[model samples]
Target: MHIQQLTIENFRNLATQTLNFHPQQNYISGCNGSGKTALLEALYSLGRGKSFRETQTRHIIAHQKDFYRLIAKIIDDKAEHLLGIERQTRDYRIRLDGENLSGLSALADLLPIQMLNSDHFALIDQGPEHRRRFTDYGLFYQDSRFLPAWQRYQYALKNRNAALRDNWPDEHIRPWHHQLSQTAQLIDQLRQIYLNDLEARLNYYHAELGGLETLNIRYHRGWAQDKTLEELLIQHLPRDRQLKHTRDGIHRAEWRIYAQEQDIAHYFSRGQQKTLLCALILAQNQVIQESSGKQPIILIDDITAELDPKRRELLLQFLTDSGAQLFITSIEALDTPKNRQHFFIQAGQLTPQS
Candidate 1:
């Protein structure tokens, strides 16, 4: 699936715009704070049902505007449809081909786009939420059977957490805990398999990116590895009550990034971290291509943010060879002579440059 066109109104600094895009590759170039990132965020929101940059939908509207609208013309094998998402009176209306929809998962079925911004490195440096999103997105792209199971796990988790907050009796929470454990065990197993596969892919790309380092990706569950999720929750029931939250389970899991036994986040320089981020994203591209027949739309904002010339060239080459359609934002035209199509974003206006 690919987006042929995008129409935005009162979204961020963009007041009104309709821009056509290429199916294979698109380059958006502009200076800092020139709405380049906003364009990418708009595309991401259309596909993912929320802004990649912010959590609240209200923040996406222009400063003085009370509402915002985004529409994308998507092309798929069956037919072409207009996926429209609009916000009014603090509620979102999702429409496909002019028919109102109930949920955003329908949007997920139509498009699977991923964005790689500078903050994407947080998947390594920050909390489990980031790593969980990364792992779940990878799973979603690789395995079609994961979505429902994952959703059920989340539902059970929320209910359990609510029970803990409400100070419910242990017997009352026991059934939810059991159900959550069953779902979590399946998720945990699948996550381990995917991480193992991702580690291999990351190593291969890291070598190609000239890192030449042995990388180890480890998943840290909230409790001991040997303990079943149900056992962990039961053991921690008293502590969880004292803490007023769910203390141990899959929700607290984290992904540890390591380079040859050293934590990369603590030891690696900024440039090294950026390079690792690029390698991981490229590896994701490879995984999706190999595991599924679909090639995801990759949005790389500010392609040359902090890297030197050599690393930039290597990243650009890797992106070109990944066989995924890329939408890259750069300050100036890239030096690579790969017949790239460029679009210029200036003062909230976007126009094709090449």
Candidate 2:
């Protein structure tokens, strides 16, 4: 799917702006703090429920503004769709073509957008949570059912933790623990499948991205070494109650990125990590396009950061070959063919330049 156009109001530095986007490739050129990243953040919020840059909806609203709204025209092989999102002081609403889209998942089918940002390097340079979230989002893109199962697991986990905090008896939490385990088992199975697929795809794409080394992704479960999830939960009941929390479950799952049996988090250079992330994103887009018969919108923020000239062209070519619409942010003009399109963004305003 591709976004035909975007309308923004009171989002970030953008007071109000509308632009007809390129269905194939769009390059937004700007200097630092020119609202280039804000544009991508707005588009990403259409797919995801929150901004990739900020945690709260109120933070995205312009200063001195009470609310913000964004709408996009999405086009696919079947039909055109309108996705609208409005945020207020207390609540948020999403609509698709005049119909109320109560659940944020409704926005996912309207537009599948994949983003590559500087923070992505954290998957390799930081702790396990970042890598786990990256893997989970990738799995979410593939399997729709995983979301509800994940939601159920999170809800049960929260309740169990609250119960522990209240000094509830161990036996009183057994039922909730069992319920959490059931959904967590399903999540674990799906995550394993996705990790296997992701590992294979990453291997091939890593080499293609000029990283000749083999890349490995390991999913570590809290009870992986213990007995079945059922047995582990039963065994850990007392320990968890003493600790006053849900100690063992999918919430504790981790993902480790490695190269040649060595931890990449401590070993890989920043440039290598960025290249690996690029390959990972490109591979994910390719897989989605090949399987779903529809390509997702690709967003690459701060494209010139730590990327060599050769790798940049190669990455751009891969995006072009994917046949997916791309929104890339850069500081300078790219020496592409005359037919290529670009927009210059300055002081929160966007205008077509090439």
Q: Which candidate is the best by TM-score?
A: 2
lDDT of 1 by residue, 68-119 (tens): 9998898876789998998864688999998998887777666777888888
RMSD after CA superposition, every candidate: 2.0, 1.6
lDDT of 2 by residue, 1-354 (tens): 688889999999974987888778888888888899999999999888678878887888999999899988888888998888999878998888899988877676567778988878777777767767777776666787788899998888888888888888767777786778789888888888888888898888888889978888877876766567767777877787789886677888888878989887777777788788888888778766664566888898877774788888888888888788888888886654556669888899998985
Backbone clashes, each candidate: 0, 0
Model 1 TM-score relative to the real fold: 0.93
Q: Which whole-number lDDT from 0 to 100 does residue 238 have in model 1?
A: 90
Best by lDDT: 2
For residue 69, give model 2's deviation from the true position in Å.
Answer: 1.0
In candidate 1, stretches whose alpha carbon ends up further than 4 angstroms from where it belongs are 335-339
TM-score of each model, in listed order: 0.93, 0.95
